[model samples]
Target: MQRFVSERILVQVGLLIVAVALFASTFGQSFSSSDLAQSPMFFPRIILVLWIGLGVISLIQSFKSDEKTRQIASWPRIGIVLVAALIYTNLIGSEGFFIPSVGFAVISLLAFGIRNPILVLLFAVLVPGSLVLLFNHTLGMPLPTSRFSYFF
Candidate 1:
């Protein structure tokens, strides 16, 4: 039992259980009777379904493989990224989404060995700007605005 529990298969099984639980939790969500299309729960449910399917496929693939091959991740690089993310999350509310996200993107790209300044600058600007526009305008979601928002 101990050996089985420690196998790679158990990790896949755990993921499957988590996915199923996430899908199940959304079952109790109530959609609007007037417009099911515009229901708030629609997108989340779709994502949950996709997650569940992926989990099942991964579990099956795990069973098919005889040897468990795990790649060693760069812990220092990962730690730097994690710290950057934490700083971004904390600063976003106070500094607004754009600046903190741009800073995070640049730091992350640099950490991942992206040496080209032009590419990094383009990505750092475009990605966060696009997300800010998408969430704020298209989805009618409000993002944190800086005190100097008027200047931008």
Candidate 2:
């Protein structure tokens, strides 16, 4: 099996599993009204249904495609990124989004062999900063904010 086929099947299967789990969880929530329009589960169920549908489509497509794309992920880099992500998740709540995310971005960039200081700093700062702005300010949704980040 080609890497492309394996990766696609794995992703689609994972998506289906997760979507089913989420759909099942929606059943556990208590609804004040049983009405379709008013029930909280209504929107979630719709979204999950769509997600499951997409997963099925992707799975079917995976078998049909014979593209021999040679792109492969580096295990060492992937492991480093996974560890960084785990650490970032742990730090996000306590240390807040900006500080943890900046550190995470820098580590991720470095792990990928991005040694350019200017690009590192630019990406490390811009990505997280834009996310904070998008979530916190633009959308009126608050992400965890560091006390140190007076402006962000």
Candidate 3:
């Protein structure tokens, strides 16, 4: 007799609800209905609502189904993905978007098994090149020249 509700799924659903509630409570502090048509809180509140709704759906789905199955999660693979994201975030301020973005992309692809050296090199160049054009030039948020701007 297998349990219908999974402990891990329940915990995750609960955490999601808590996170959504926290976001929702902070909404009133940053935004009011009259602040603007598109206030800062508008997007966050919408996201919070969606998150809570999904959490509820997850809870219901978990309970309504039975016969739980499990698969082994490869921690090394997960760690590699997280490390890539962190590298991108950390280098974004110092190295600018170009180098860090390209490096992160290439490393991420390799972590996921893109073994061909040539293909990995192309991906590294293309990903950051696209980002530079899209965000720096097209979006007008030019990449910072150097850390000297803040260090000084």
- Index of the highest-lDDT prediction: 2
Residue pairs in candidate 2 whose N, alpha carbon or C atoms collide under 3 angstroms? none
lDDT accuracy of residue 26 in candidate 3: 70
What TM-scores do the predictions have? 0.50, 0.56, 0.49
lDDT at residue 52 of model 3 (Cα atoms): 80
Superposition TM-score, candidate 1 onto the true structure: 0.50
Q: What is the clash count for each candidate, in the order shown?
A: 0, 0, 0
What is the Å distance of residue 99 in model 3 from its true position? Answer: 1.9
Stretches of model 2 off by over 4 angstroms after superposition:
1-5, 68-70, 92-152
Each model's C-alpha lDDT? 0.83, 0.86, 0.74
lDDT of 1 by residue, 1-152 (tens): 44345458777788778878887877676655525567676777788888889988877776665665565488778888999999999998899999999999999999898999999999999998999899999999978987778796
Candidate structures ordered by TM-score, highest first: 2, 1, 3
lDDT of 3: 0.74
Global lDDT for candidate 2? Answer: 0.86
| Weakest 10 consecutive residues of candidate 3 by summed lDDT | 143-152
